[model samples]
Target: MKKESKNIKKNKIVDQFEFDEFQKWKIEKEKERIKTHVPTIYGYARVSTEEQHLEPQIKQLKNSGAKKIYQEKWTGTTTKRPIFEKLISLLLSGDTLMVTKLDRFARNTQEALTTVEDLNKRGIKINILNMGYFDDSPNGKLMFTMFSAFAQFEHDLIVSRTQEGKAYAKKYDPHYKDGRPKKFTEEQVELAWELRKQGNTYKMINRKTGISIKTLQRRFNELKLKDSE
Candidate 1:
């Protein structure tokens, strides 16, 4: 009986050691899998024009832990964004595409929906900082569709109001100009033209008057046409 007891005790110890080793091996395998298949988060930032700054969007994206960021100064209304296309082409399954806002990602509703659906099909996710994460779930699709439509509506409303205001101004305000206010005064333009008449090249006039060569040439030609009339 004493010999049998000893054998049982030995067997128990061996079984315990084997169980512990298997657990350790399982943990190591899980770590290896995670290392091999970790997902990447990519950020995209955009502005409508050159005058707009991208620093704010970049700062937010970095704070949100984006590994790579793509940016452009192109308008969101068009779907032919070169940088955006390159970024999209690089995205793979199990990646996240992040943007600061819906409008920053896409201005057109149909374009936004189609792009998001394609990403969803590929198992990629979208994280709009102001909104939240979106995925392939039904709720996610509904919420994204609603927000995209609302954004487009807001844009169209603003454009409609601007057109109406412009028409009213043209009718009532004789001093109103059709587009952006002139950066330079008539006096400044006339003086620049005088420098040109004194045998100063456009480059020389630009250096002296702080006007760009293109602006100088365009203004000078306009002045010449007015004088001829």
Candidate 2:
């Protein structure tokens, strides 16, 4: 009778061990399932100037199921983005980084390529709303590289064209100033001068011509100096 009790106790212990192993396997499989199906999606939106609105990009990202978003009103040429850096640090290997467009991701080729490569190495995927998804796959890499190159080329071409146009203008046009166009035109300045000569107060001239009193006074003084010379 004691021998029979020992055999039953041994079987019970074995059964408990098997049960624990099965529970551990079940927990691991559950974790794997969640990891496969529920990747976190992060969105980024950016504009070059404060005047540009982030609403459109934000809305698009929301519609595309981004769980969180980072936004900025910063020039893309600059390398420092504190919020962006924070967001990048939080991203995990299975996460996806989504952006409204390539320009929003990066303004130049080198920045884009380097960022993408780093993310790819860490098993992070990128989703550009206008360009579709990109991963570490051979085809995805090729396409992303080509797109980045084109983006840089386009920006450079635009800058080169603008410089050429400015150079041509400077050579051909005697009155062309090499900076921002004047807010008030030469005709407007002439009108202000005429008003000043008629003994109008700077305040009165400002009300009449929409030019600021300071500007009118400065111009009138300059013109007086030129006449005396």
Candidate 3:
């Protein structure tokens, strides 16, 4: 009877020890799983023109421990940017997206706010390098809101200045045009009209005169003779 009791106690102790070891192993496995599932950081950069520098933005992102980087040369006013779309597609929940500056990501407040809100909805974080904080925090949210307001204000100011300038220009230079200057010179316009009189296609005139087909057509329209009364 005594021997049986001792064997029973020993078995219970062995079972408990095995159960504790298994629990420890399970906890370690859970930690390893969490570590592996953590998301990576991605960086994005953009320059409006070829003359602008991109190296500084790239270097800043690298220093921030960005694992991936996407870049493009395009104006910020358009939402049809290739790399920007690519970055959006690559983001996943818990991922961090970093940019060197606000204007680097978007030229206007509405676009910037929309982008940030979209990322937030996906459980992704956005880090603006100059702001010195991640966008997921309360303070960061306030700061972003303020900054966006300022950006909108600045855009409004720019528009106002542009309108004032255009008004002044119109008063002074009646022929001032807002966009690209006409490609066809006065001589080219005359030649285009002469070619059109000889039945030359706009394409042929474009190839011959190095003027765009649209410009050639416009020149032809400008020289169309009125029908005799």
Pairs in clash, predicted candidate 1: none
lDDT by residue (tens digit), candidate 1, 166-201: 999999999998988889999999999988889999
Candidate 1, superposed: residue stretches over 4 Å from native:
1-38
Range of the 10 consecutive residues with the lowest summed lDDT in candidate 2: 30-39
- Over 100-182, each residue of candidate 3 has an lDDT whose tens digit, in order, gives 88777677767887788889888889888887554656886688878877877887898899999998998899899887686
Total clashes in model 2, counting residue pairs 3 or more apart in sequence or in different chains: 0
The lDDT leader among the candidates is 1
Cα lDDT for residue 46, candidate 1: 91
Q: What's the distance in Å from true for residue 25, model 3?
A: 36
**Could you tell me which residue pairs clash in candidate 2?**
none
Residue-level error in angstroms, candidate 1, position 54: 0.4
TM-score of each: 0.81, 0.62, 0.59
lDDT by residue (tens digit), candidate 2, 86-113: 8887677889999988988887777888
Compare candidates 2 and 3 on TM-score and give the better one.
Answer: 2
> How does model 3 score by TM-score?
0.59
Top TM-score model: 1
Flag the better candidate by lDDT, 2 or 3: 2
